[model samples]
Target: MVADQFGLRAIPTVYFLQQGQPIDGFQGPQSEKFIREILTHILQTAEELKIAQATELMATGKTAEALPLLKEAHQLEPKNSDISLTYAEALITLNQLDESQKILNTIAIQDQDSRYQGLLAQIELQKKAADTPEIKQLQETFAQQPENAELAVQLALKLHEVNRNEEALEILLTFLKKDLSAGDGSVKKTMMDILSALGSSDPLTNRYRHQIYSILY
Candidate 1:
């Protein structure tokens, strides 16, 4: 069962089991340094266990419960990006955008991975959603000139400013269908921005992205 579960195909396959579950494994000979690093990671200390527990809580939609655990873990490992990112996510979910941004900004630009960028985009989107006057003005202008392509693009930006992302994308899509080469690629850029802010997994983003691909090709 162990061999089958671990998919051991070679003669000297090694499986690192933690609590009867395969956490890490190697199929062949590895250097001492590589083996050491793997072992160090696999063997979690008390603080690591706490962070793991917090991560599970967050995954299960228990951010309130996870926040304290993550805070403790962060205190223990202040520079750990994993903990910081999770904590920032929790804060974002709780509507503590300022605090989340502060934590995110502490992460060095060189260390800003995709997750960091995603969180930052989320924060910016949230901030944009709060700009009521600009959004209202754009909405009024767009309503007055619904057929104007430039107004449509500006209105889409206004919609995105207020978290009406689907509406924003639809506006852009309508304009692009009529003029795929609009705004010297500014239309495509706006669409891409909305898609990026929505993240790659969003169904609407996927749909519109497919449309964009068809238009481009």
Candidate 2:
């Protein structure tokens, strides 16, 4: 039954998987050299493997899906500038200007290569646009009326306009944490909208969805 489920037909059919998906397969006997190459590709260091996966995600415009893997790779090996740069690049894609800048800042003077500079430049340019007058004004007013749910929603809307998604989501989540049913469920609704905008594949969507489920269930 299992062999049929996996579509195995030949006696020596074999499949190799990475991250739970089949990446390579051979239906008949293979040369030792070819088999060794497959083993080597699958046996790479965890950090590099993550970076490779993250690179593919970023290349395909799946920034949200790529971010957690890159972050994990960074945590596993902080000294590897390649991982840090990949993580930073994802942050830039998500318009996480502050976090991306912080990561770029960690690179040593010698390791401040072209990729680091490019990410840094992107953050600087985006940060300037992000520090707009409307956001500034809304942030100031929201800071003063920290408990006002209406004001919180207003500011979150502004943050969402410029693609500061994580920041906007964080602001909404904070209020939701305080009062899950605040504003007659409008607060939760706003969070749902943010998650929807973040896409179903996003790690943030899954993480935040679980958080909301935990509170309700």
Candidate 3:
């Protein structure tokens, strides 16, 4: 009856239940050590679990998805260098360069490992990428013709090319505020593209999307 209730079909089944509901489980004959390890993990604190999950997300190149989790984990464990490094990495991926540098700089000297050095190098690269002469030229052109929807969209597109997505979206949204369907909706189209490129998991993407909604409704 117990097996039937859970719909058990395997001979060796393990289930970790919390609050009368299963939170994790595995099926198969396993060593006692493996089972003990699973139990140990199940007993870990929320902060530990969050950092572990965020690390996995970061490993999979889902930095946007990991950012919030890592941010929470960092808040929970401010003194933890590993968590700080990960949060900084996620920030860099999202182009929050200054914030990322600040976080990285706070790590203790003894805890500054290879990962810390790598993040520093990454910050420099991102800074250099965000300052190309062409982007400057576009900025100048856009400034001279701020009301030109076509020029605004063109400059925004150029910004997007260099991973400056937030700025790209801002330029487009600024134009959209004055003329929602600028250049036959090309401006909104570009905004959508920038947001999409930022990924659904990115907070800025969500925020800007809400701004777009406000413009529409």
Using TM-score as the measure, the top candidate is 3
lDDT per residue, candidate 3, 119-187, as tens digits?
999999888878889889988988898888888888889888877776788888888888888979999
Q: TM-scores across all candidates?
A: 0.45, 0.61, 0.62
Ranking the candidates on TM-score from highest down gives: 3, 2, 1
Error of 2 at 215 (Å): 4.0
- lDDT per residue (tens digit) for residues 61-171 in model 2: 998888889989999999888788888888888876767877888887889988788888888888788878988998999889888887788788788788776777788
What are the clash counts of all predictions, listed in order?
A: 0, 0, 0
96: Cα error in model 1, Å: 0.5
Give candidate 1's error at residue 171 in angstroms.
Answer: 38
RMSD of 3: 10.0
Candidate 3 lDDT trough over 10 residues, lowest sum? 197-206
Which regions of candidate 1 fall more than 4 Å away from where they truly are?
Answer: 1-17, 21-42, 133-217
Measured by lDDT, the strongest candidate is 3
RMSD of each: 15.6, 9.8, 10.0
Give the Cα error of residue 5 in candidate 1, in Å. Answer: 17
lDDT (Cα, tens digit) per residue for candidate 1, span 94-208 = 6556667767877866779999999999988876766588777887887888777777778788776655676788888887887886766677789899899866534456788
